[model samples]
Target chain A: MGVPDPADAELVRRARNGEKVAFEEIVRRHGPAMYRFGLRMLRDEHAVRDCVQEAFASAWEALDQYRGDAAVKTWLFSILANKVRRYLRSQARSVPTEIDEGVIHSPAQHEPERRAIAGTMMAALEEALDELPLAQRACWILYEVEGLSYRRIAQIQGMSVDAVRGAIYRARQGLERRLEAWR
Target chain B: MEMSPERDLGPPSDLLARAAGELRQLTDDGWVRAEQGVLDRVARALRSARPVRGRHEGGDFFLSSTVLCAQVGTRVDLIPGVRASSVRIVTDDVDHLDAVTLTVSVAYGQAIADVGSRARGEAAAAATAALGVQVRTDQVTVDVLVEDVFVDEARDDGGADDAGED
Candidate 1:
């Protein structure tokens, strides 16, 4: 755990006091990351946008119940994780179909050498991520990419800490095997 | 045959870092364009999800706080010598539209008192026109933001000079 962000706390306070702008600020601050998480989970841009919207709306309606126990980011991510799961279930899909290479745009497109290396590595990693089971992938992303602790990931995923760890461990092993060529 | 210890796999730290970086890049690119759209969608969804405020004698009715905030925000922005950087409306009772508190920010260097009064009057008028309800001036509070003082002051001073030459 880290120090609570005062700005986020203040925003949350004002939002709770019925300030629409404060709540909008909260959505703006966290919306992009939530969108990214949705894209990674669902791999559909439209679906990602819908999921992020649903999650924020849900958060806003339930703001009164938010106890401030978790960081606002974590709270939002938790809501988003639930939204993604519900979306997946609603679609009657088990695994996300394929990695959309179009989603991974190079930040420096003109730098040929860096672009080639990053593109290849990113493609490989996306494949590896796709290969992971949904649970393992969720845990891996929350822990490794989002820098959440195993306990926090467990809370978000509704599992034990050990289970989160095991899932992450398996995900890492699978990815390492799939990405050995890059090393 | 069992795999050799030397070949045992581990976490792909470097790959993970690179992937995180790539994912961030992808998100950053999309976000710049999608931010306002996303907020609008979220705002719409939230407003729709709220309970209906019940029927008036005229017909069925529901008032969206989001819409009201936007109206007030627009009215404040249209005021001379002031730009509404942010507008926040606190509704104590969403169903009745009573005890509403409007908080707003105006561009700096203008007469704060005059701007505040005008903003309150305009917002109240806009809300009454839009919602068919009286929004009293006492319900609005204004905060003057000094952060944009330099730019606003420059624009104000330069606008007249440029206009005279033209």
Candidate 2:
């Protein structure tokens, strides 16, 4: 259905004041976004759901620690990134194969040629993505697909903004290198 | 069906692109549901045990975790694709007609030998009886701690799986 008014600040205020209903409201308002963040990072729905839940749980506990230096979305996104990193650490040894689930509508307006090429290109891009280091993968997905800003990415990842830029740059170069052979 | 040439020939570029396209598909329901259930149980326990946090600074640390042990036991062993020689429930508490610790025994080398020491029996239980009591699975090598007896009476709510071991 529809969401309530954008009252994250108010809700967070209530939540900090110990209103679980307010907290629940915040969860309802932001759950989808948080879920999307986890989905992009984990690529495994199970792991994504887990990371989302963990991020929420940790945020609930750590909300008191929030200094209000950033927006609620940025804060929540930061927590989700930490959760994702911790998950990767625990399962670092194993190969994580993420199965994505979204309907890919072919390029609608014009550009059938690019669509054909892009479709083929998308496959190679994904393989390279899967093969890419987790840091690089997170940077690429967050930077290109999600369109998050570098500072936001850094906040999410608990790193310097410059580090985020470096990661994104490295990721872009990797994708470009992979696509070069196709060109 | 007009299959893409990439699918058939599998060039490095075609392979990579196809893999990328397929990489976004989401499939993992069972795992999510199971973990959700575990977290729910955990949340409840954390809430219930918060009251006793100050009361049991040291001695109560072990007592506060009774229900947690059960929760972990259920999660770790209940999942599919696990095998065990046995799951031994080890605890010093030995005086109960029912509601015995759901003891499980693992074969040797399953966990460190020193872990056996943490499986001591105490009059400890969760502050909120409903949450039950449990300890850290990773911290302890409890295959199971079947309760054969206890000095005090436990809740008679018939709340859980009460396997009476003679």
TM-scores, one per candidate: 0.56, 0.45
Q: Whose TM-score is greatest here?
A: 1
Residue A19 of model 1, lDDT score: 76
User: Candidate 2 at residue A153, lDDT?
Assistant: 64
Residues B39-124 of candidate 2: C-alpha lDDT, one tens digit per residue: 45325422222111212334333332333333333343432222211222333343111122333333323342332333322112
Model 2 Cα lDDT, one tens digit per residue, A29-130: 666556645654555655666777777777776554343435677777777777777676566534365422211111121233224435565545545565
Name the regions of candidate 1 deviating beyond 4 angstroms.
A93-119, B1-12, B47-166
Q: Report per-prediction Cα RMSD to one decimal.
A: 17.2, 18.5
State the fnat of candidate 2 relative to the true structure: 0.02
